[model samples]
Target: MTTTRRPGAYHCGIDAAMDVIGGKWKVLILWALDERARRFGELRRLLPGITEKVLASHLRELETAKIVRREEFEEVPPRVEYSLTPRGVALNEALAPLGAWGREHVIGGTAVTPGG
Candidate 1:
């Protein structure tokens, strides 16, 4: 999976970072993989709203960015797992503050009420 670089694009560090992790699903996928390696099905189960195709696409993009590593095992049924690479770990750490903000602010407003 090779991406063609656009001429004169991504002039800043934020540009480069967003190029890798931009989108609703990519960051969520990275968060899911932060704790431990997970198989394809496990990831799908973890992220309830994601469709199979979308999850597959995001995983491919993360793998291409070298943020996530895909490991295949030789077995009777063939097994594969996805885990965060060192780069991904660093990225996740960098996102901690943002995550905290979302949890403290965003989730509070969006959570459902008992009768509403």
Candidate 2:
């Protein structure tokens, strides 16, 4: 996610995909946006450990990737909402099986930690 690729620069499809979602937070951010559009504050509340700086940076990156759409409304206090684009929705659908695998193997079988 830190590096941008030029056209045809990837060795393979997975390489390109990983480049887009390589960080600890990117996929989680995508998942958070899976349901509906949310304001910045809402996203902050959904993800507890993320700092404002990191969230803002990730959102900007995601926006550039065309996976997240940001819309700002003219209002008294000003409102900005973020949601998945069509591509993002398809990406989430593709991630569904991965999520199910994690639920089956990682979450279901793992031993509990102290507060985890």
Candidate 3:
């Protein structure tokens, strides 16, 4: 599908959406944080193959997009947690069926259900 660019449109929804949450890692990050907020270390562990730097970058992008919110607690050792914003939660809801379909048909080697 080709999308037309409008003049002076710095924030087209489609383009902005793709920019915010594009790439494999970002969706996985969103998925991991869907149910509950997690610390940086927790996210790293949940997504085993991702490097710390890459995860940090993705998190920053998501936070900037307003999809993810980061909360920091000051103490002797600072604590940080990441959670989905309302927008992120809505996107997650939209993607849920796609994820389920991928798991069932694409990964499990079964035929995709109609309309999925």
Candidate 4:
């Protein structure tokens, strides 16, 4: 697949990182990976209703961006799993507060409960 390198202003690491992971399903996928490493099928199971094509495409994009690692096992039938990189983990940590804020303000319209 040909990558179209678009010219734009990503002023910092945060911006560049956001550029990679800022999509509708990407954060959800990252949140899933935040739990544990999972195979494609497992991820699909966790996120019901996502098309295989879209998942495959996003996985490829995340892999390309170095936010996620694709590990392939050379077993009888090759098995592959996806996990977040260190950078991705850091990104997830940074997003936790935002997620909390959104859930409290956007979803519930109330103060956030600590660890709830």
Candidate topping lDDT: 2
Q: Compute the lDDT of residue 2 as modeled in candidate 3.
A: 21
Per-residue lDDT tens digits for candidate 1, residues 2-102, read 34445468799877888888878889899999899999999999999999988888898889889999999999799999999999999999999999988
Model 3 misplaced stretches (Cα beyond 4 Å): 1-16, 111-116
Give TM per candidate: 0.84, 0.90, 0.78, 0.81
Largest TM-score belongs to which candidate? 2
Which portions of model 2 miss their true places by more than 4 Å? 111-116
What is the C-alpha local distance difference test score of each model?
0.88, 0.89, 0.85, 0.85
Candidate 4: clashing pairs of residues = none
Q: Write the per-residue lDDT of candidate 3 for residues 14-50, one digit (tens) a residue.
A: 6656655678799999999999999999999999999
Please, what are the lDDT tens digits per residue for candidate 2 over residues 29-83? 9999999999999999999999999999999988898999999999989999999
Task: Tell me how candidate 4 scores on lDDT.
Answer: 0.85
Clashing pairs in 3: none
